[model samples]
Target: MKKDYNFGYTKVNSKQKTKLVQNVFSSVAPSYDIMNDLMSLGMHRLWKKRFVEIMDIKENDIILDVGSGSGDIAREILKENLLTNLYLLDLNKEMLFEGKNRLKKEKNIKYFIGNAEKLNFKNNFFDKYTISFCLRNVTEYLLSIKEAYRVLKPGGKYCCLEFSTPKSSLISSTYKIYKSKILPFLGEVIAKDKNAYKYLSESIDLFPSQEELRKNLLDCGFTNVETINLFNGIVAIHTGYKL
Candidate 1:
């Protein structure tokens, strides 16, 4: 029996979901950054900045950034600590190519086309692991979380920045309207791919909440689990340590 997972609002088996997600990213790869600005009104940039700040990157720390779309978070981390060794991994080759193109000038940065649930790196290799706005789309998010735990060295930290449930009723209602109605419209006009953006909106709603994610981190042996809500919990940064 094949286990089912979400491909947007539609349910499919794990392999289909992975292929569907890859197609979605491939279709939107060219316009991803543009649509991000349009979708979040440039708030994603600030969110990533704050996400990196919370990481408190140190000089020469080895970092693995999973689902490292377009290298936005990688760029932010490098800006803070240029000496940090960075690995950017993504399932979609097009997305990885975009990231590689953007960070072409940076040193100590390597990009790989890979899956988050099954990272290629050896156990306890990375000092810090990060996945931004990417886990929701994974075929098995729990497996990805476990992989994050597996790859981080003892005493290393894991940070995940993602769209999460909102704290306020009014904002939540408005955000829902924007996501369901406005986002796909912008995707069509800007990215010329409405379905891809539709998946983005649907995926966010289906993703685990901050507390739920904190519990997952705890379950995976991540201690000192903490969540920092940004924009009133519309987006959140979850951090934990492998002790």
Candidate 2:
């Protein structure tokens, strides 16, 4: 039997969830970047900037960036090291095209319309794997993590940046209000799609906690799993390595 997955607050079968998510990204692709800036209050850029820095990209490192929406991470990585080979993958073609257009002048970069749960890459191919602000939206989080593990070369590193649970009660309460109220309001006024943002907000609430995610990486054969919390855990960067 097919398993059910979270489509935000909605429960859906895997296939249903995939199609629904594709539709959502397709609807918002054009305004995705702008909405990201407003939704995170311009902090997402800072997070990605720090994320790429932590990546410590090297010249000629082969990297695969999953769910590479609008190529923000790709842009940052290339800026640090233009010689690195980057492969950007996204389940939604619209989002991939958005990245493609944004990175047209960028060489040594390839784009693929692909699923995270089943990456098209061969085993032990990538020196580094990254996914930012995209994992909670995946239908099968563990499967995708395993896929990230599968594709990385031995000693390769994996990095994931996503919205996370806050450690403080005060920040948690305020963040809840911001996501449930302010996020949808900004989405409606800017992206004209309140429901999509509502779904995104709910997805973050449903995602696993930091410790749980760390255990997941360990179980999937990643060594030295570590997490760096940002904004008191409103967002986090998780890094692991296949050693």
Best by lDDT: 1
Q: TM-score for all predictions?
A: 0.98, 0.98
lDDT of 2: 0.92
CA RMSD per model (angstroms): 0.8, 1.0
Indicate the worst ten consecutive residues by lDDT in candidate 2: 77-86
Q: Which residue runs of candidate 2 sit more than 4 Å off their true CA positions?
A: none
Report lDDT (CA) for all predictions: 0.93, 0.92
Cα lDDT tens digits for candidate 2, 1-243? 766788988998888988888888999999999999888789999999999988878888999999998999999998785588899999988999999998999889988989999998899999999999889888888999999999999999999999888999999999999999998898899999999989888888999999999999999999989999999999999999998
For residues 115-144, could you state the per-residue lDDT of candidate 1 as single tens digits? 999988999999999999999988989999
Cα deviation at 4, candidate 1, in Å, is 1.5
User: Compared to the true structure, candidate 2 yields what TM-score?
Assistant: 0.98
